[model samples]
Target: MERLNKPLTTRQERFCQSFVIYGSGAVAARAAGYKARSSNRQGWRLLQSVRVRERIREIQASLADHRGRANDVIIGKLEMVYHRAMENYQYHAAARAAQMQAKLFQGIEETRAELAAAGIGRDDEDRDRETPNNSPELAGPKMMTFDDNSREIDKACTQMSTWKKRV
Candidate 1:
């Protein structure tokens, strides 16, 4: 009796069996004594066409469904990580702000203590005179001099020198 799906050839049957076992068209084609390496590429392309593509799509849809369930687990883990990072950032910021405020208050208190120790009240008038002006030239004592005879003496010296040089 003839088989319903008779083998294309004995070699073809062996090629199909080798492909199924090894999952490699190149190996199977070589085993089946196909001359060109491209014959294996064609075999692989044919396996991906039409009926084979539909079957593969079904398997891939099943895998995608499984991955969707795993995505929920990964999202939960990532949310926990996000919340932890935000909490850590907020805690560090609040701690740094508190530390800064404490340092500022401590500096103010020390300044107040120093003022009290020096017997200088905050509104003392002596502090105003003692406050140094920023200008270097205006900070020292001012001097003024008036000499009416100096110009006449300078003119006499100039005329005397000119007369001496000409002689």
Candidate 2:
């Protein structure tokens, strides 16, 4: 669902954007200027719409930029969910949040390794913060192609072998 065949109404568009920002249906609905009395119900109802769901996903993907800061945002949100679930004694929800966090960390580590293999090592990553112009294309976690991913994996294996021999 790239663009909605029929564009969302102004209120629906506002609700979608606000939902992403607030991560709360009722809050987002109110923020979107829905009627206060029925905002809670409308909020959940709006999410049930296929067009609304796709539009929201599209908006979220668009918000993700080349810098990979979206990963940090995702991790932060997961951590917040984990903490809230734990506080409420929702064991299943807390566990799911923790699992998502681990998966995110795995991807981050692989991206760092791939960047390292590309000669933009850890130090270079830090230097890149001060100079954002360097390696703009490779800065994001999802920037690498399948061939590049395969090459990075091979490089990582070779480095692991050298590390074992050094020990």
Candidate 3:
């Protein structure tokens, strides 16, 4: 039921309710008994009413509140699922979370390696002797050659520079 303080005709109230349900003003107008050919115009006119807009806002707020409650219910169910998974020794979900965590930390490792290569070694005694790309052990699993990687890095840096200048 509409809770608008402002006066509205029954048809106008129907228009608001139908609009909320269908998300199409023309369809709502038609449902509210306007002729199909003129539904769009009538819908636009009804939308101009302060009372109608207020009623629509009330409907939308109610729908949002319902959705919020529904989400809470869903989260509660998910928590139960998580507990059940843990009890059943289902490691897949835990493993997936760990994989995501590892991916997030991948950047940190790359930055640390880069910093070590820049003469700021992880240990103070170990001096930065050569570029990371030069060290076979330090070079990543891809085994990318120094020249190819260097060219790619240069190209990317150039493109970034061009983009920065444009921005």
lDDT values for all models: 0.47, 0.72, 0.61
lDDT of 2 by residue, 1-167 (tens): 43548889999999999998778889889999998999999999999888899989987777654234667668766766766765775655656666677788789889889988899756644556453667644444433222433443354445545663443
- Best by the lDDT measure: 2
Best candidate, TM-score: 2
Instruction: State the TM-score for model 2.
Output: 0.47
Sort by TM-score, best first.
2, 3, 1
Residue-level lDDT tens digits of model 1 in 1-167? 33434434565555665554445667766776775757678567535545443444455455445434343233333333333433554433333333343455466569768998999675442243232764433532221111332443344445445663444
Q: Cα lDDT of model 2 overall?
A: 0.72
lDDT of 3 by residue, 57-159 (tens): 9887786565343433333334344344445555444233333434444655687789978877554322242245656345222222224335433544455
The TM-score between candidate 1 and the true structure equals 0.23
Please list all clashing residue pairs in model 3, or write none if there are none: none
Q: Which should have the higher TM-score, number 1 or number 2? A: 2
Q: For every model shown, what is its TM-score relative to the native structure?
A: 0.23, 0.47, 0.38
Itemize residue pairs with steric clashes in candidate 2.
none
What TM value does model 3 have?
0.38
